[model samples]
Target chain A: METTALLRQLSEAVGPPGYEAPVAELIERLWRPYVDELRRDPLGNLIARRRGSGAEPRPVLLLAAHMDEIALLVSGYAEAYGHGYLRIEPIGGIDRRVLLGQRVWVHPRDGEPLPGLIATPPPHILSQSERKKVPPWDHLFIDPGLPIEQLEARVRIGDPITFRADYLELKNRRVAGKAFDNRVSVAVVTLALAALLERTHAWDIVAVATVQEEVGLYGATTAAYGVAPTAAVALDGTFARQHDVGEDEAVALDGGPAIGVGPNFHPYLVDRLKEVAEHHEIAHQIEAIPRGSGTDAWAIQVSREGIPTALLSVPMRYMHQPVELLSLRDVERAARLLTEFIADLRADERPVWEDEHGS
Target chain B: MDFELLHRLTTAFGPSGYEAAVRELIRKEVAPLVDEVEVTPLGTLIAHKKGSGPRLLLAAHMDEIGVIVSYVEDKGFLRFAPLGGIFPLYAIAQRVRFANGVEGVVAVERRKDESKPPALSEMYIDIGAPSREASPIRVGEPAVFVGETVRVGERIIGKTMDDRIGCYLLIDFLRRLRTSRFDLYVAFTSQEETTLSGARTAAFGIEPDMAVAVDVTLTGDTPKALPMAVELGKGPAIKVKDRGMVAHPRVRDAMVEAAEREGLPYQMEILTFGTTDAAAMQLARAGVPSGCLSIPCRHVHSPGEMVDVNDVERAVALLLALVA
Candidate 1:
């Protein structure tokens, strides 16, 4: 499948933090044909492994991209003037301002997805003070345009609600959708897996479509523990250039993919990846995550003793918003670069870091 | 009955997202009392007691507010960010524990003007690791206040007593309940301080008719606290409202009636800030009527939240009476 087609399907799929089954199934289908074995752990992390030809205890490389995205959970239902307005709390780190006036799809328990839009007060009705203060997420509700009984029949508490929109391909080679944050990475990983299947590497590879990365990197933590890989790479999205965002600070959308360096990133592993990128003449940038990268790399790096992990990020715009954007070229390059990097790893060249226990 | 269990549980180093130790401790405590106990995909320990009536969900979040190592500077000094709501004033000059069993002291930024309180961003934890590379502490590892529960007068003060006190109460109640009318599901939830992910999943899987969240509430006894109406040692506070979820009127009334019938002193807690699992539990099914039984606490969400041991016992008694 084409990367854009996969991106569209992955973006449209409903998989918030605790609910990742739908996306996991989708990922499994996409990855089933290219790998030797595929299994989902108890935490719903889709792990697909391809074996290497050599039997010499080669380094195991983990490639992770979170299948979950930021959405809303219907906390309570409010009926005003016979119309149902569902109260919602954010599932992940979503900007409250972007939520207002946007269309949403309410996935009720047993019925069709209901169409709704965030209810916003008109400027005429709002006082100056009300206008000045940014509305808290609790103050917003989804107007489903249905009566209380109709809504109650279809929608229940804990039903995952997502943005009701399609991916838009912009004129500047950017793609916009609700969950481009890690879905773009998902697309990149899928493409990388497809490329990897056509060749054999010295290292075994595990491509993981992890769940709950938006929440707290829960899926990656368990997956890393279960995989116990020698080396891992988390393919995720990072901040990209947007309007008013500084060009110097922001990674451009078409700037291939950014490799994270600094504290959270393993120094030698990052150096090796950069060397591979340079050798292959792939476009890449460097991101300095002085503290936590706030990605699955944080969890993967410290799982059991220590795993030398590197984070390869696709530059994405409007991160953590309803409509996150990514460049198609960057996604393709990230997958290609990772494929080349993995193919270059030798059996005897496994990088080691100082374990937490000082072994 | 098991003070050793409590000691281990309270001493275990865990913050909101980093709750493996507390989960393991609670798993051991409830292993015998529960027919089956399993940690959920979200790290919540769900201990089930099979019965013949409606399902009853009991929740106590094991996660507490702490700090995450943001950066380790060249001098082995570490900058931190509060994993949850931590008071900047209280964190200065306090001790903390990293996830890897490393100890550190929170250092406040030296300001030319000594009168000002340091911001959370300005605070750093200094563990004698010598250099940045030598420090076992890595970025993103959670560190909590290193303190032990101490009895002062009639109250117990410690780090993470906010909901651990509630966890202690749940363990006490489950151990004492010889017969239960409802199929009880007691969940020691994770990440309640940062997000409600654990409670959302636990409640969905349990699918209970009612949920009673045991947590801590701010008390009016604290000096200059916005009149919270709940007083410390005034028995368990039955929560009516919080920023997250309004208690179902029926559930709230049921607890009130139970307290009145048992002649247990109770207070109505209306929290202006922060929420509990009651929010997520209320919205779990088509709508489960959910309420909260909170132990009135002073200095909530801080390193040293104060709670009366009597209040903890009363909260357990109220839950036992209600579930019985």
Candidate 2:
């Protein structure tokens, strides 16, 4: 499969936090043929399991990528000048400053995705002091180009609206689009499932597309509670460097996939990933998150009896924005590294640690 | 008998997820008292005192809220996000200690107009890491206040007093449990500030019949605060309710009656905000009757949380009476 095409399909899917059925269905269609059995929990997390031919008490390897993305919900609507303006609040983490005067696609439950643009006061009409203050999220509205009665017939209170930007291929192997913060990871996990299905792996592999990660990783917590895998890895995106951004803080876009290592990361799992990266010659960078990682790993590490977990993050630029960007090389590398790591684990043997202080 | 052990447990640096130091210290303290002790999968210390009866769990989280290195700027300055709920107003101009023994001061960026309290995003810690490579501190290292426990007019002011005080009380309680009616399981849990992960799992594994969580609550005596009924020097506060979980009615009444019979000076604690491990334990398996015995302290979740030493003694005494 073409990586860019998969990314495009993923970016075009509509799945916001707490509403992930459409995206989960799309992912199930894409990955069903590649795994032994596919299961979804009540939280709409799609888990594709490929069982090893080993005996009972087989060690399970869970590779998770969240399917939900940040979007807007229509809270209320009003009519002015024969056009319907929908009041909205962000359903996930969104920068209020970037929403001004941008085109969006509102996906109401009953009708087609309607086109709209963020309506804000004209800068020239505002006083100098008023221009300096950023408009609050409540002040912004979406003009959906329809009369109030017609809009009310189609749109509802909880309709999701996403940015209308198309996926763009940038220079130097970088591709940008909305929802790439996690959809790119979803595509990578799909590719890893494809790779693992072709070979006979030693451990049981579970490819999980979790939901509600953008909110608080709620989906991964419940899915982890149910799965209770011995070892797990969450594939997600990390902040990448842009112009004027702190270089020390940013992981480079093409630098490679990042391996999260620290107190939150299991030490033995980190070593295992490092060993697999070396063996497969995959380009990988080390990211140390000493405390709670604010990711699915935070929930996964402390699941039932505690699952030894690690995080594999593809560097993403402009995260939580309409135009999140990632390098294709990094995405493919993350998939390859995860595939190698899962294939290397043994069903009967536990990952070895130097001492009992595993963190 | 071992004041040094108590001092070591209090002075050791272990914030929420990174609680190895505190866990090790508690392990040493419980080695002689319990028959067998092991660290739980969630970094909680589960010490077992063998007896043949229903299981009773006593929980004290070992982790405290601190800061994690979020990003390092180009100029080698470190920006941080709090590991738990840290008041940005109190964080400014304070000292922090890194995991690698590096010291840093958290300073607010001087804006042209500074009227409002600095947002946590605008704050940075300067560890004197000249460059990204030389900093030794990576994005995700945990840092806490660089301070030691001290006695200030019958009060103990120290870093991580929120849960470490409870840890000390658990150690003292384990030492006093000679003939137990119930099989006692004492757990020093982790990540109580971030999520109740440690206690949740410990309860699932132990499957206790009843549980009592030991943690700290805010004192009403602090100047210009809400009118909470709890106060310092009033012994341990028997928690009625908090933002997280309501104390079990049976367990709450029992604790109150036990405190009254023992003549232990106790106060009714009503925490409008914040939670304890009792909340997580309450939701375990059909449900366990759970309650919290909180020590009233000033400036909870801060580096210099103030607690009265007499309250600590009373808290331990109440636990002894409940078990006896």
Candidate 3:
């Protein structure tokens, strides 16, 4: 599948944290040809193991990218003028500024997702002070435009909600959509797996479409423990340089992926990734993740006596918002860099601490 | 409760990544108690007492919230970023102690309007050095709040009681524990204040069948505090829901049953903000049923956090009853 088309489908998929089956199904179909074995862990992590061309007990390289997106959960139900509206609570860190005027989907237990519009009091009805303030979760409601009886019967409390934004293609190969904060990274892993089909590697590659990373690094943490890979790399999105974002914190869109370095990543793996990027002449940026990368890398690093984890992130604009933007070229570069790194790994070599290696 | 031991645990300089001091204290206290003990690469202290049943991982972080010097100014001022959640208003005018025992006062830059509290960036630590060259504290030095654990009537007050109190309770439980139906893996985790990284790995390594985190929760007993049902004088709060976790029903029920069976006065906690190590443990490896036992505290994330001694004792009893 073309990267843009796949990304668009991924962007439109409604897979909130704790409910990532939609995205997982898509990933399973796309990653089936490139991997040797595919299965879901008990916690719903999509694990695809691509065997390496090495002897028995081959070193494993785990690639993790969260498939879950930041979304909302219906917390309560209310009625205004006999029309039903639902209150919401955030599933992850969602900026309140973008919640207003967004179209959403309310997924119930046993029915097709109901289309809804995020609504607040009109400007004429809202007080002056209220107009200046972003509506609180309690004040904002999802208007499914259904009658009271139908809304009550169809939508129950605790239904999952997702942004209903369409993927938009922009100039300079940049695309805008929701859930690209991680779905693009999932695509990167897929692209890497696809690239690996034409090449031979020495280490086993387990590409995982991790779930519930938006809520916590649950999927990655569990997958790391279950896989116990020799080393792991997390693919995610970083903040692209945009208005109001500082230069130090944000990278340039379409420049390349950002290779994370800090406490969350082992020094040896960081160096190895940089070496691979430079050797391949892959355009990339060094992101100084002073602490946790707030990605699957954070959990994977500390999983099961600590896996040597690294993060390669494509830069995206307006992170955590409904209209996230990123470059397709950056996504491809990240995949290429990862594939090259994996193919470069030797059967005898393992990503460990510098001091852990023999003097 | 041993106030002296509590004092030692609370006063120890273990802030997030720098948890050696506190880890050593715990290791010394727990090494003799458990059958085996080991420190993970990320510095989480895991001690196991062998049992022939489902493994139960109990987590309590030894690390506390602190600040690391990000920039040392030419004028000897230190600009720091918070290692965890630090409020500028609550931290202003407070003293902080570095790992080397160098003390500095947190002070905000004088602004044109003092109506709103200063941001952390506008605040600097004054260590009394005249210039950058003479500054004893270098950049990247981490410092924690300088407050000693003190007894205020029936309540114990101190800094970092948020989880040190939890650590104390675990130690107390280990001392009193006679037998258990499940394999008890007590993890004195690191970096709960920052990333919960210690608990994350420790849980994975143990791969427990179930886990419970002992930590402090905010109380509404204070005047004009947020409307929570918990208070310091109340018994341990059984986790219901927090920002990070919706406590697994089975694990949460176990705690509630433990409390009810023991006839302990426990509160059902529903904290709208903040979370504990149980959130990380709950999702470790496929998934482990997990919940938290919260020690209701007044003024969380502040220098003068207070917890009731009675509540602490009750929590220990409840844990013992649960394990038994």
Please write out the lDDT profile of model 3 over residues A209-323, one tens digit for every residue: 9999988899997898899888889999988888886553466888899887545766577788889999999999866554677789987888776777888999998889988
lDDT of 1 by residue, A146-210 (tens): 89998887888999888877888788677888888788888888888899878878888998999
Reference-based lDDT, residue A89, model 3: 92
Which docking band does candidate 1 fall into? incorrect
**Cα misplacement distance, residue B148 of candidate 1 (Å):** 2.1
Sort by TM-score, top down from the best: 2, 3, 1
**Candidate achieving higher lDDT, 2 or 3:** 3
Q: Which stretches of candidate 1 lie over 4 Å from their true place?
A: A1-187, A199-235, A240-312, A315-359, B1-4, B111-116
TM-score of chain B of each: 0.95, 0.97, 0.99
Stretches of candidate 3 off by over 4 Å are: B1-324
True contacts kept of each: 0.00, 0.32, 0.24
Instruction: Return the interface RMSD of model 1.
Output: 10.0
Candidate 2 per-residue lDDT, tens place, A300-346, comes to 88777677788999999888888898999999998898878877777
Chain A alone, model 1, TM-score?
0.95
lDDT for B293 (candidate 2): 96
In terms of TM-score, the best-performing candidate is 2
